[model samples]
Target chain A: MTASSSLDGVLAPVLTPFGPDLSVDEARFIRLARTLMDQGLGLAPFGTTSEGNSLSVDEKIGLMDALAAAGLDMARMMPGTGCCALSDSVRLSAHAVTLGCGGVLMLPPFYYKNPSEDGLFAAFAETIERVGDARLRVFLYHFPQQSQVPITLSLIERLLKAYPGIVAGAKDSSGDFANMEAMCTHFPGFKVFAGTERLILSVMRAGGAGCISANANIHGAAMLDLVRRWQEPDAAKHQTALEGFRSVMEGLPLIAALKAVTARRTGEPEWRRVRPPLVQFPVEREEELMERLKGIGVLG
Target chain B: MTASSSLDGVLAPVLTPFGPDLSVDEARFIRLARTLMDQGLGLAPFGTTSEGNSLSVDEKIGLMDALAAAGLDMARMMPGTGCCALSDSVRLSAHAVTLGCGGVLMLPPFYYKNPSEDGLFAAFAETIERVGDARLRVFLYHFPQQSQVPITLSLIERLLKAYPGIVAGAKDSSGDFANMEAMCTHFPGFKVFAGTERLILSVMRAGGAGCISANANIHGAAMLDLVRRWQEPDAAKHQTALEGFRSVMEGLPLIAALKAVTARRTGEPEWRRVRPPLVQFPVEREEELMERLKGIGVLG
Candidate 1:
């Protein structure tokens, strides 16, 4: 179950679960993986939704090992292995390959702001070179808005040319349709995944692989349907559903809110506990979010 | 000793030395710390120069503990503990306080770009609340240039007003003297440290807590002399020497070049291994840097 085939369908940045004490709830993570997969999602855990940045390197590896041991097919998994430090990134990405993950989604070394496009190329190239695993599939994770480090088009071209097999595609979380369009057109055969659900159909139209969205945790079936109906005559309905979900998450802490909903749904109230500095949804915010989720009629 | 007095003085953002295998060279770190302190420097380790961001949470804590155990006085130490994660930041800041560190220089939650000022306030406020350590002297580390998240004047005011005792001061690494001046004037009691040595004279005139500089690693004595004799009629000579040393570092990767110089002076060539993504000084750059250091006549 190695991820040898193209990642050409719906994949969700799976939500991470925590116990009431905010420890990684391994049982819940496995259950979430199984549930999302059953709901037709290819998995990308330890992503933004998973608070990938929040987890320590050891914790990330532990979660991945847990998933693999639970027999989740690696081909369907693309865990985020990016970190500010290259050593951590390499270790995570290499371990993912060893576990047969279809690909490791690598974010640019993000701590250094406005790093030259050349620096980014060198970082990626060196990591791929150092990993020295021909089986390694490198998918660039572009979330410039959050990272404050843009992965320019030129760097992507340089990487693809240098390591054709290793640099497979990108997860474009830039939130700019023009950038998404540019990525799709500029790089032939490089699979581009939309960062958000709002642009799923548009991204699909622009030749994107699929969306790796945070909202897909709760709206997995609908998101999958949205991708499926991209070419359908009634495709506008899918787009509207995505917009509704987007509206709920806008101007709020999307990750925090998403975890709250998932916790309630999965009968694990403790899963609602977010790590510090990212407080749990206040009572009013939680109620409003729950009401909105019910209105979307996906609570079932 | 607790830092009851102003943390004024020429504080060097000391560089960390790693063995060829990239493990922490505790001997080099201690030697460097002792040499700088002997030359009248206040110590600020695990900062941008020390590749603090590259270190894991445990590594940072260990470095702090090692320095303390090496007889580095807490009142003279200002460790860089800023990170993207809140819990990590809290742990670092809290531990520093417990160890009686002068203050923890904190970078904001940097992964998320352009976070609202309110969000920034929440982050700082939450950290102080969670640490709950009165011994803590929090210094807002405003390195907008690197963090990509600027701490605005309004946010600073809000933080100061809300947590008067917790928000002690700030280190403005923005390099804009006017901003530094504004901070000094606006927050009269606030200890403001200029990030670079270039503004030492101006910042000093503006009631600023002397410079917290990267170049101070090699220029400590010269910078201290200038600070000590700012009122001396012959202080211009000291200022010129300081500026010359600054220009040398400005020509190279400031952190790496400082480590190289420190290693050379201390006869520890192995002290120059920066962590991954930040490669070592090329031989040519090293030679060029050495020539500048020699030309400045600051080194034998």
Candidate 2:
């Protein structure tokens, strides 16, 4: 099936909340996701900001089940399902499709470095074949910095040629506008989402899909404003404001900083909790960050 | 409990053979492990050479169970049990320990880059505590090139301090002898295995544990000879020969090249099958590699 038209627009790679015991705080997480949806943003959970790799498959499946049971519209969701193991990618992507989710963000098997393009194509091919679902619509997750595995254009072309409908689009988290432009330019119909909101205007003006960004967790309304006003004379002003807020989040470990901000805003201290290999933002840094946000009028 | 004395010597990061349908060939795997044991070398399955990350958790556990059922001595096995997910690593490691395996080669949670030492320490601490098995003995697997996560000397020190008996040693795959040297020098009683057989002599001479090399899958006898002769006067000569053979394997993708060599030796065409994101060595390159091996008197 073709990608859902609703898949486009300002989407937040939703931040995951954890309890004091470090288990995924499902209620807090759903509340945050619902808040984003209420603000007119699409939901892209389990992206880099969500500590997707740090979580187990069972945890992810359970979270999806929770979201579905909460009566959240699955059509607005595009969960990140890529993993180092093919089996994991299959398991996650199949679950999303079965849930009638809009699409799945598939990362190329990231464990092996410098794999042949043919090898990567084979991986995507295998996943699609194994899932064997007509409803499967894949938006390739291309975050080279984090995964160290680039989704090159040639590989994309090959996948598109082989599976025209299933290989729907990509999220260019390379943070390279030039690469995003290339994807938009080279393939006319392929959806290309800017990973960062900083280039939202440029991407939209260049005939590309909207952004799926980390900062959208806190700044979804501002980003949605930019998406709606890209053709307006004051668009650049909106872009500047979005970038300003994004820079604040980028100043620290992005995920931890986001959690810290959410904890302060919601008055839920458990929002500050992070799983291991990802320590919570230091207390002093959290205070400084809050002061800066307040100074910038992001916080009162 | 402390690490078993059986944890020493030339250990093969045993290669995994896949069936034509891309399924793990469990019987073939057990046969290879038995052959390595017969040749007086230890077994370290699911390592880089074994495509450990490519295999799913279920596949790895099944293979381990098959080996255990075949009456292979678990005391001589140290399977690589690291994954990007903490729960997956814990699961695999706990299974290995439950099977009475001697030790586990653990890779740090690798998906996140530039994590704080405290963060890494916390990851290891949680895994060790969660597994909570007195029989668990962890040998940290440090391969910066692959995992992009280095097991720093300081982190090692912290883990050792936190879990003395459980944190036994490390496998230094950084290919940086100085780092290996520092690990060997600073940690006197801790076992340190040279990742490559080239450093076997120096590692043994420096009071390190032994060598865990990919080439041992095909050339276990040669490596065992070098291990035994590291203290003899002709030790340097043996090291030189071992390096030469390793160089031949390193001339191409180490895993694919080794598989090609195995396919040629055993006349099992299925031995050439590799999972996605890792292609087979090209037929032309395979012929050339065989010619080179024969030239070096390594092939008949």
Candidate 3:
């Protein structure tokens, strides 16, 4: 499966499950992935929702191995393999390609701020060259709000010029429609995934690819339906509903709120645990979130 | 030696030298460390000046081992060991303690933004517990401008109460004197180091520990002199000179400019190479910076 064909739908940035000891609950994680796949959603593991940066390299690899061991289609998975260190990025990206992952969501080296376009290009170039995998497809993750390192159009252009086949796509998590529209219009064939579900309908209508969103963990079917019928007469209605649910999710700590919804749905309280530098969703906030989610008919 | 005495006075946040291929110039690094020590300065490796976050874990360990092998006094060195991952921080901190280093300068787990105080405290707690060393002394690196995660006084109070010996002090790189002053007065006996040499005289006069400044890479003696004469009547004169040099350095990209100065002074152009996500200083900008420095009687 090529990168474009395999990853052209609503992909869920899956929430990682952790045990009481804060160790990754791999069994539960695999179960969650299988559940999402059964619902016809693609898997995007080790993303912002997955607390990918918090996990050690060994832990990330171990989780990926577990998913493969469970017999999931690797082509349906686009794991986030970016790291601050070039070697770490190279290691994870190579492993994903070897595992037959359709693509990898790559973030720029985020530690330093205000990097030059040449430097950003060099980082991506070095990683791709070092990975040395012909099958590697990189979807640049441009979430400047969090990473503080924006993947500018010029850098994208340079990467595309240098490695057309490997630099396949991008996810614009900047939450700016103009930027996403610019990406879609500027690169005719480049796959562009909306980072939020609220923008799914508009993105699909604007000749872009689907979204890779955190809310897809619970609302994948609704988002996928929007993607499938974006041209229909009542598409705006679905878009509005998604916007409502997304607003509720965004009103709280996104990762924790998503975990709360997953815990409630799956009857597994263990899903509520987040690694340090990320605390659990506060109990009162979770209660309020559940109320709002239920009011929007998302949770019962 | 205790963390307090060994890390006192002027400390240089050393500059890292990269070869033509951008691989770490380990021999040059060791030579610079030795030279700094000869000038009565302590070594703080793996700092923002050292591009600590850019280096891979193995590379960092290799450099630390090289420093020890060269018979430098580890007790006077406080390497920056914090990372976005808890395991990385634990490994680096533990290694520093085992190497008999005086202390480790740790940035809070910085990937997640808007984290709660509890979460930040938990991250430090987990790392300290995991390192499990009696000699581990952590000087919190509070550089909100870069990390976007500030280490507040309340958090410091909590950590000091919990781990009195381990939570040693902080380097206020926020460039906000008011915040640094709060740190000094709010917690008596806590070692506080100014991040910039421009603040060195005021920091010392306020009964804080000296400074760990990037300008120390080129002007260690000037800073040490100010530290020694802080209580004297002529202290302000030294401070004015240091401030003049610092203002010149601050006028450009700090890391690249420092590298440029080092290159010109040592007649080794290799000193100007910075890793990706940081390009080399532009020729025209370098010339401008050199002119400004010479006008200030710095690089003659």
Candidate 4:
């Protein structure tokens, strides 16, 4: 149950930037990863916030080199490698492992809904077996709201029993804090993560790893600050302040809103552009969003 | 708007054949497709039944050439080309178009669930625009049960109005006959389809073009026979026979059941192998399945 892992920290699923042609802006991606690392945050690139599902396998692979070139250690980066296809997952994970990534956050094959646990287990097992690199580590992504293929506790238990070390942990984004708490308690050594910073204090108290949040793209330093000092008495107050962002994000298109704020912060309009099936945050709301962020001291 | 399309008939979302190693067996796939076509079925080679999501984009692209090489006219095929990534979807659709395929059946981006109509519309519009092919025709695949993103009427109307000749039709796999009937009634000359043969008679009666069914893999001739003769007096009797397959498929793992029967019929055990996330049909259930099929006269 040693917490001697590079992955056990506050990580941001880096928001992807796209050029005018809606292509992956590798330079921007690397720059963001570097900036987050400089702020003492680990990086979980290519998770939902990055619109990982919106990028092709080649595009995802193409952006990895820039991270290395930017002097960002692969050891602190956990790129999301899950695709609907087993072969695609294997290739992406194998590539990540080769580059010394801390771990690959994996989503179940989400296209098929309500698959049996045995079927899901087989999917995870096959990917792990095919990747074949002993260096490979996996975090089962449990965002039931987005990915209807839920990674239930029994499924986790099965994976843990089968491949103890390789099945490292999970990211619970069901917005169900109880599930996150249960995961942290049940899997003693596993690195469980909350999808938002609001649960960081509670998750940490439960012996969980840390937060891998969408908001961390904009508030990396703040989240990392709390992560490092959550044992203090004022941790709840810190969490409450952080919880303000979620209220701002509520009822708005979340990923789009995050991108909008990133665009404002970085002075790069391209940060606001999302891939198709994800419209940009409305221009009309930007003023209100910024005002609210400033109200909570989330923006200066 | 003339019903002269090769795609306007019974098309099997052709069952994929996997080898012992679990890689797509191109030769077996071509052989099965050829057999189905020979039995008077059009081909939708990469739909849900085909384990389309279980395949990588390259793997899907690699299989297309074999369909062309088998003396199978691509104009008689409408391959499923949707992916979670817009680029991947565009690439797949464009590839299908270039090969002279009649149409591409497209699932909306299935990864991010509950995307807005605007976002979904933008995804479709973007894929169509980026593909930039005039000859391309698309069948908006509405399989909400698996994809979780339902293609509502308003979304369909938007797509249709925007792309007159291009947004040719839809395949309603909701198993809700009312929706299919409504599509047929609401949009004149739009080709609506049922996802199974049991609904074929009803769909065609309501002006649906035909069916793109999974059972067509095992029972192509029987369904196609019913499709051709549904206008005849004894059509109900023919449909009753076809409906028997659904009863057997009920409460069983569908794709696996289809594959097991295909294996038995072809005398190729390899047909039973599915990619990971979908285990082979339970060996124990094979006998009962076979017995039931026999009872229904689905087996010789």
What TM-score does chain B get in every candidate?
0.95, 0.97, 0.97, 0.97
**In candidate 2, what are the lDDT values of residues A130-213, reduced to their tens digit?**
999988999999989988999999988998899988888899999899999999888878888999999999999988878998
The DockQ of predicted model 2 stands at 0.78
- Tell me the TM-score for chain B of model 1: 0.95
Question: After superposition, which runs of candidate 4 have C-alpha atoms over 4 Å from their true positions?
Answer: A1-4, B2-4
Task: Determine which window of 10 residues in candidate 3 chain A has minimal summed lDDT.
Answer: A1-10
Every prediction's TM-score for the first chain? 0.95, 0.97, 0.97, 0.97
> Which whole-number lDDT from 0 to 100 does residue B226 have in model 1?
69
Residue pairs in candidate 4 whose N, alpha carbon or C atoms collide under 3 angstroms: none
Give the least accurate 10-residue stretch of model 1 chain B, judged by summed lDDT.
B1-10
TM-scores of the models, in the given order? 0.85, 0.97, 0.95, 0.98
Sorted on DockQ, best first, the list reads: 4, 2, 3, 1
Task: Please report, in order, the local distance difference test score of every candidate based on alpha carbons.
Answer: 0.79, 0.87, 0.88, 0.88
Report the candidate with higher TM-score, 1 versus 3. Answer: 3
For residues A60-110, write the lDDT of model 1, one tens digit per residue. Answer: 889999999999888888899888866677788999999999898888888
lDDT tens readout by residue for model 1, B1-300:
123454678888888878665667777788888888888788888788778887777777888888889887878888988777666787888899899887888888777666667668888887788789887887888888888888888988998888776677888999899988988899877888888877777887788778888888877777777676677787666666677677666646666677777767777778677765566666567666777778768786
Q: On residues A1-300, what C-alpha lDDT tens digit does candidate 4 reach at each position? A: 333389877899999999998989998888888888888899998899889999999998888767876778889989999999988998999999888898999999888788888889999999999998777889999998888879999999999988878888898888898998888788889999888887888888988888999888888788888888899999888888888866877778889998998888888888999998999999889989999988888867
Question: Tens digit of lDDT per residue, candidate 2, span B22-69?
Answer: 889999888889988999998999998999988888889999999999
Candidates arranged by TM-score, highest first: 4, 2, 3, 1
